[model samples]
Target: MGTSASKLAILDIVLNGLMRRYKERVPDVGIILDAMVSDGIVKSTSDIENDHIAFRTMGVPQLGVKSFEKIFLHFGYEKRDHYFFEGKKLDAWWYSPPRATDPRIFVSELRVGDLSEESQHIIHSYTNEVTVDGIATDPVDYLDLDNGEAVDAFLHQPLWRTPTTADYQSLLQESEYAAWVIYNRYYLNHFTISVHNLPEGYNTVASFNDFLEKHGIKLNTSGGKIKVSPDGGLLQSSTVAEMLDAEFANGEKLRISGSYVEFAERKVLPEFASLPAGEIKRKHRRDGFEAGNADKIFESTYTTQTGR
Candidate 1:
């Protein structure tokens, strides 16, 4: 799929905004880039191809995949496969880029109603604040998607009131994903690194992981250091979430999960094995995601991984 140059320009601005803030919030982004440059992985950060970027949402009528997807769709992204994480009480989807050079998008939403009544109440008490005239609101409905500045601001802006420490803790006990969305509304969750493109010695998750550990970067060990797809076509790993000194309501302070970096290695498809290395392209590689891999990847932000 393709869009007009004007729209593409706006998309660039919006994506740049998301990544800029993401890198700032997650220090590992810069740490990894700087180390990569020093180690001759590439000349600079620009040489690393972004595999994908992800976001989390509250699965309510006001905002979720149905509402948040309009922004990218307007910019020419085509919605592809849908993934459901029953254990996490979430639903997710992946969107293909308008151009091969752009990163894919992975967005997931919390199934609020599935939570315990108390947990649901705590989430609604805050999420319910995002309203105008007592009716649920879809924040993106008012955005001029073509206006890059406004959209960029919206991505970083808070949609609800600050969550109280008690409410946040209660939700966290039941669903870490819920607690995350409650505080970090619409913040880019994680941006991925396509390790397969790096110089030969650092071209796989295993090798890149060793490089990261040597530089003091922490890896999420929820499922294992590496979460591989059943077919062995996709392998992944991520940094344990960076903890932030969060300030909740009433001056309550606690260290909370922020964001993290993910590394992905998508092996070339079997059918494309005969293709010449110079001739192979993104299409010849494993496409889309594997739910089994993503399920563990989600824990990158969970306390289980972050606390490690």
Candidate 2:
């Protein structure tokens, strides 16, 4: 395969693995992705260019942002700007890709210290059970940059022990972030499609939302269906996560919201709008994420938003 083709193949393998695990948890991902293909929005899964993929982690001494990010860093992704969500108690950062075709990465960790002591104890109890030092050692074993299998393994590795139903309910009352990570572990929380790369008439988030709604997908309306950046260069929307059955550590099974997909439309900068469409590249478009928009989008999997 050519260089571009080789990169696409690697991305395809990574995405397919992530999607398989995601679909196993949230069936709607298969429904939505299949519809995207059958409806002609994307000729095939490989045709859709992902703007970014997000992961959620716990902010603890051992397995927070630093440990998890090592895998992506091994793959040549560089850390970028930091974003803080006071209400959500999250500290996040976006990673730039080594290659233009590779998707950007956004990762956020729940500030365990910000939570009540009781909540912190509940979270740490699980983290402590998983690793003696609270730091994850799985990713360290797979630090080979060329090992695509290692990257895939790191993405789906289980990082903590499941919590009891009572503990989960308690965590939910205090911090949904805590409850989510306990169950979902290091799975891909969401992946965004680059709407700007879509064909005309469907290149905007509004139009894409229409297409998703037409297929019976319900979107998260926490801060309105579309969250726009201050400069109006970045637009985003996500479907409320599908509810999935979860068996607590106590053996009580309950239906809870799982991961969801995201759509992003990045407009060309004012300076680039005058250039021909063919002349525009990824750098010409809005490249970074917006805190205001991401803050709302983060609710896509919350019970309040997903109605689970």
Candidate number with greatest lDDT: 1
Question: Candidate 1 lDDT, tens digit per residue, 1-308?
Answer: 45999999999999999999998899989999999999888998898899999999998888889999999999999999999899999999999999899999999999988999999888878778878788888878889998999999999998888889888888899899998989899999999999997888898999999999999999999789999999999999999999999988888898999999999999999998999878878899998999999999999889998887
**TM-score versus the correct structure, for each prediction:** 0.98, 0.91
lDDT of 1 at 93: 97
Number of clashing pairs per prediction, in order: 0, 0
Badly placed stretches (over 4 Å) of model 1 are none
lDDT by residue (221-273, candidate 2, tens digit) is 98999999999999999989877788888688888777898999999998888
Best by TM-score: 1
Candidate 2 minimal-lDDT segment of 10 residues: 1-10
Which residue window of length 10 is worst by lDDT in model 1? 123-132
Predictions in order: lDDT? 0.92, 0.83
